[model samples]
Target: MRALFRGLSPFNVTRRLYRWTMKAVRRAVEHFRRSLRLQLITTFVFCLLAALLAATLAHGMTETLYKRPYVDYTLSMQRMDWETRHLATIIRDQSETDISALQPMLDNFEQDVGLRMLLVNLDGKVLLKSAKATESQVDLYSVISRAMELRLDLNVFHPQEFVAFYPVELAGQKGYLIARGMPEANIRYESTGVNMISVPVFLVVLIYLFYRFTRRKTGYIEELADSLLVISQGKLDHRVEVRGEDELGSLARNINRMAQDLQENIERERQAEKTKNELITNVSHDLRTPLTSVLGYLRLLKDHPAGGLEQQEYTRIAYEKAEHLKRLVEDLFEYTTLSGQGVQLYRQTICMNELVEQLVEEYVPLAEEQQLSFCKALPDERLYVSVDPEKFVRVLENLFSNAIKYGKKPGSIGVTLAREADGIRLSVANRADEMAPEALNRLFERFYRVEQSRSRKTGGSGLGLAIVKSIVELHGGSIKADYRDGVLSFHIWLPVPGS
Candidate 1:
C-alpha cells in the first residue's frame, strides 16, 4: 500500500510537472535569447513589470499618507453622530426640562466626549447650548427647511468649519442636535496636491531609467560597428576593446586576434620582399664576376692558340673559373630546394656516433693540408637519430669545410659528439680569429659572410651554413653558432629516435 501511495503521491506528481515546466522554460529562454525580436519583446515586458511595480509602491504610500486618515476621520464622525443620538434619547426618556438637573450630564458629555452640542425646538430656536457659540446668528428655520427638502438627516452647521446638525424627535417634539468643535483636519488639501504631482514625476523617472538601461545595452553594438569600420580602413594594428563576457565581447576578442595576425603577416611579407631583393643583388654580383673572368680568359685562349704556354695558362684559368661558377650555382640550387616546404626527405635511423666518426676521418686529410690539427671527442655508446642521410651528411661536411677554411694557422679543429638527456649534441669548434658577437647571430643567413674572416679564396658560395640550418630544421633539430675564447663553435642538437 505504501508503494501504491508513493506512485500516486501529489508530491511526486508535482515534482515531475515542475521538471517539465522548468525544461520548457529553459528552451523558451534560449529561443528568446537567440531571436532579436523575442529579446526585444522580453525587455519590453520586463520594463513594463518594473513600471507597474513602481506604480504599485507609489499607490501604497499614497493610501497610507492620505486615504487611510481620511477614512478614519469619516468613521469618527459617524461614531460622534451615534453618541449624540444616544444622549438625546436619554434626555427624552428622563423627560427632563429643568436646566439644573441636566447641566451636570451635559457638562460631563462635553468634557468626556470633547464635542459641543446644542438642542433646538421645532421653531428652530436654540433651547440649550453645552458650549459657547462663536459664529454669527443665522436663519436656522430656512437651513432646516432646505435640509429637509433635500431629505438630508444632517446639514452643515457653518461654512469653513467641521460642524454638523442632525434633526431628531425627543419626547414627542421635533428638534435639532448640533455638533461642533470636531478634531482638526488630518488629511490636508496640500498633501493631496503633492500626491497628484508625485505620481507623474515617478513615472517620468521610471521611463528615463529604462531608456538609459536599454541605451547602455545597445551601446556595445555601436562600438562593434565603429571598430569594424576602423579595421576596414586598413588599420591592422587597431584592436577592439572587450567590455563583457557575453557574445559581443567574444566577437571583439576574435576581431583583435584577427587584426594581430594580419599585422604580423603584413610585416613578414615586407621582410621577405627585402630579403628577396638582397638575394638577387648578391647573386647577380657573384655570378657576373665569375662569368666575366671565365669569358675573358676563354677569349684570350681562343685568339692565341699558337702562343703555346700562355694559351695553356689561359685555358687552365678559364677552367677553374667555370668550375667555381658551377659550384656557386649548384650550392644556390641546393639551398633553394632545401628551403622549400615541399622538399621530400628519405628518413632512416642512423647511428650518429658512427656517422660522426666516419665524417671526422674523411676531413682529417683536409685538416692536415690546411696545417690545422684534428681533435675528436666521441662517446662509445651508440646514439641513434632519424634523419635524411644525404642531407645530414651535407650538414656535417659544410661545418668541417668551414672549419678547414677559417681555422687559425696551426690551430686545432675539434669535433665532439655526446648523448644528452633530451637528444644528441654535436659540437664542431675551430680555433680561429675572434669573431664579432653580431656576426654569430646571423651566421646562418643565406649568402651572409663575415668580411673580416671570410673571402672568395675560401672557395664557398656562402650558402653552406644556411643549407645546414634548413636541413637541421627539416629533421626537427636546431643549430646555433657561438664564439668564445678565440674558438668559433657550431652546435647541433638532434632528437634521438623515439625521444
Candidate 2:
C-alpha cells in the first residue's frame, strides 16, 4: 500500500520519470563514448563531409576569380559581333550614299562602348576608321572573303584581341565592317596550372584530416600493447592509460585489475608458504621437547629394573609429559580443522549467563591452584545467544587457562559478561606482565607466543588462542586483546539473537 501511494504521488512519479530519462540519456552517451565501431564510422562521415565542403569552396573560388572574366568576355564579343553586323547591313543599304555620314555615328559608338570600328572597300583599303582604330590592324578583304566563303554574315576572331567581321557592299562591291574590343584577360589560362595542383592538394588535406582524427586511437592501442607486454614479463605494477570509455579503455582497466589481483595472490601465496615453514619449525621444536622427556623417563624406567617407588615416579613423569604432548596434538588438530574452509557449526540458543558461570566455576579450581582468584561479573537477566556449545566451551577454556597461567601470583582473573546495544560482550581480563602493542596484536595468530621460552615452560603449544579465535569467528563472533597498565584483557563479542 505504501509502495502504491508512493507510485501515485505526483512528486514521486515526476522524480522517478526524470531519473529514468536521465539514466537513459546517460546510457546513450556512455554507449557513444565507448563504441569503437561507432566512433570510426562517425569520423569517416565527418571527414567525408569536410572534404566535400572544402572542394565546394575551392570550386566556387575558382569559378568566381578565374572563370568569370572569360565568360563575360565571350558574351561581350558576341554583342560586338551583332553590332558590327548591323553596321555592315546599314552600309549595304546605303552603298551609293555618302558613307562618311556613318563616320560620326561610328565614332560616337566607339567612344561610348570602348571599341574600334573600321569600314573597308573591296580593295582592302580602310575607307573609314574610329579614333581608337589607329592602333588596330585588319585584313578586311580577306576577312570578308572568308566570311563569304563560309556563308557567314557575322564572324568573331581571337588572336591578341577580340575582333568581329561582317560582310557588306560598298560602291556595289564586296567589303566588310570590323569591330575590335578590349584584349582578353588570361586568368583562366593561368589558373590551369593551379587547377592541376589543386586536386593533389585537396587529397593531401583530406588525408591529413583523417590522420589527425585516427592517430589518437592508434597511438592508444600501441601504448596498451606495450603495457601488456611489460605486464606479461612479470611487471604486474605496470598499467595502461585509459583514454576513453571505449572498448580499448575497458580492456586496459580489465588488464590492470587482473594484474593487481595476481600481484595480491602471489603475495598471499608467499605469506602462506612462510607461515607453513614457521609452523613446521615451531611444531617440530614443541613436539620434540615433550617427546624427548617422555622417552627419557621411559628409558630410565627400562634401564633400572627396580620395580619400586622410583619406577612409579618415572612412570608418573612420563605419563604427565605424554599427557601434555597429547593435549598439544589435540590443540593443533582442532586449530587446523577450525582454520579450514566450510567448518560446520552446531548452533543452539543458550543462556549466555549460565554458560559463563559454569565455565568460570569449572576453571575456579585451576585458577586457585595457580594462586589466582576469580572476579566474575555476569548479568542477572538470562541473556540468550545462538552458538555451538562445544566451541563456546573451548573459547572460554582457552581464555581462562591463559589468564590463570599468565596472571601474576595472588592476582585475580576478572570475567565479565554484559549486554551491549549491538551484541553480548564477554571479557576475561587479568593482571599479568604488561605486553607490547605488537604482541597484543599477534595474540590470536596461529603458533604465536609473546615469550617463546615462557610459553614452553607453561607447556603451551601457542595454538590455544588461535583455535579459540577461529571457533569464535566461525560462530559469527569476534575477539580482541587489549593491554592497559599491568592488565592484559581478551574481549569477545558475540551477536545476540536477532542483533
Candidate 3:
C-alpha cells in the first residue's frame, strides 16, 4: 500500500495523467475538426455556461435537503436536553407506583427510539441508564468537515419554524419545554455520486453531438473521394449522386461534367482511327491493280521465243516479284476503301431464299470446273430483310470466291443462309488446313497473311475478308471467322427490321 501510494503521488501521477489527457483531447479534437464545419470555441463556451447553471442548482438542492425540518437537522445537545426533561416527567410522576417502574419504562423507551437514555445527578454521576452503550458513529465529524471546506457554520443550524412541546408533571415541579429542530440531513457521495459529473453536463452533450456530426461529414467526404478515383480511371460513364446544393454536391456535378466531356473525346478518337484505317486500305488497292497488269505484260515478254534463255529466266523472275508487289498494293487499297466508307443502304426488302438459290446455281459450275462439290443449306422459308441489294450480292460473291480459292482440290464447299433471332446468319465454309487462332484474330486487317491458305497460291488479295467486314458493318451488322476440323468458315449477322 505504501509503494502504491508513492507511485500515485500527485506530483508524479497527476501531472502525467493531465498531460496524457490533454494530448488525447487535442488529437481527438483535431480528428473531429477535419470532419466539422463548426467551431469548438462555441461549444466550449456553451458547456461552461451549462456547468455554472447546473452547479448552482445542485448547491441549492443540497442546501435545501440539509435545512428540511423533517430531517431534524439541529445540533444533538438541544435534542438530548428536551428528551431528558421528557423522561424525567415519566420518572417523577405523581401518579401511583411511577418511581418503581421508571427504570423499566426508560429501557422500553430506549428500545423503541434507539437512543441511549441517561439521568445524571447534579455532581455529574450517572444516576440511571437504559441503553447498553453510547453512539460512536456520530454525524458531527462529517458536518464539521464540509463546514470547514465550504467555509460555513453548518453545526450552528437555524431552528425550524415547527416545534414539538412536552408537558411534564413531576412531584414538586411543573415545567413546559418546546423542542425545535432535530439532526442535520446527510448528503453522501456514495448515494449521489452521479451529481459530481453533472457539473460538466454540457461538455458531454457537446462531445456527443460533435462525434455524430463528424462521423456523418467524414463518411460523405470519403465517398466523394472514392468516386473521384473511379472517374480518374477512365470510367466516364460513372456519376455521383448529389447530396444537396452544398459544396460536396457542387464538386460532384463538376466531376460528372468532366466525365461527360472525356467520354465524348474518346468516341471522337475511335472514329478518327476508323477513318485512318479506311484511307490506308483504299491507297493500297489503287496502287496494286495497275502494278498487277504491268507485271503480267512483263511475264508475256519473258515467255517469248524471241528472248534469250538466261535473260528470259531473269525476266520471268522479275515478273513474278512484280506480281507479288501488285497483290500487296491491291490488298492495301481494298482494306482502305472498306474502312473509310460509311453505310449507304440501297435498302430493299428482298427474298433471301431465291437469292441464295440463284447465286448457288451460278457458282456451282465454277466449283465443278475445279473438281470440287458445292453444297448449300439455305433457309426454305422465303426469308426477307432490308438490304442494299447490290452490296449484298458482292458480299456473297466475295465469300464464295474465298471458299473456292482455299478449298482442297475435289473437296466440298458449303454456303448457308439462316434466319436468326435478331437477324440473318450467312455462313460460307471450305475445307482447308487448321487455321491459326491468332490469324483469326487479325483476319480483317489489310494484307494480314497467314502461312497456310494466305499464300499467293490461294490467290487472295488478303482484303476480301476485310471488305466483307466493312460491308457487313455498314449494314449495321458484324462478321466473324472460325477455323475448325479443316473447315475455314466465315459467319455474318445482319439485323432484321424489328431487331
**Which structure among the candidates has the greatest lDDT?**
2
Tens-place lDDT digits, model 3, residues 5-119: 9988989887999899999999877655443233444455665676567667665566434442433234453454456466656555643554335577757765654445544
Model 3 lDDT on a 0 to 1 scale = 0.66
lDDT of each: 0.75, 0.78, 0.66
Relative to the true structure, candidate 1 reaches a TM of 0.48
Which runs in model 2 stand beyond 4 Å of their true positions?
A: 1-306
The lDDT of model 1 is: 0.75
Native-to-model Cα distance after best TM-score fit, residue 20 in candidate 3, in Å: 18
Estimate, for each residue in 92-147, the C-alpha lDDT of model 1 and write its tens digit: 66663564466577677878777776767766566667755433343576655643
Q: Candidate 3, after superposition: displacement of residue 120 in Å?
A: 20
TM-score of each: 0.48, 0.46, 0.49
Model 1: lowest-lDDT 10 consecutive positions:
153-162
Global CA lDDT computed for model 2: 0.78
**CA displacement after TM-score superposition, residue 467 of candidate 2 (Å):** 0.5
Cα error, candidate 3, residue 312 (Å)? 7.5
Clashes of 2: 0
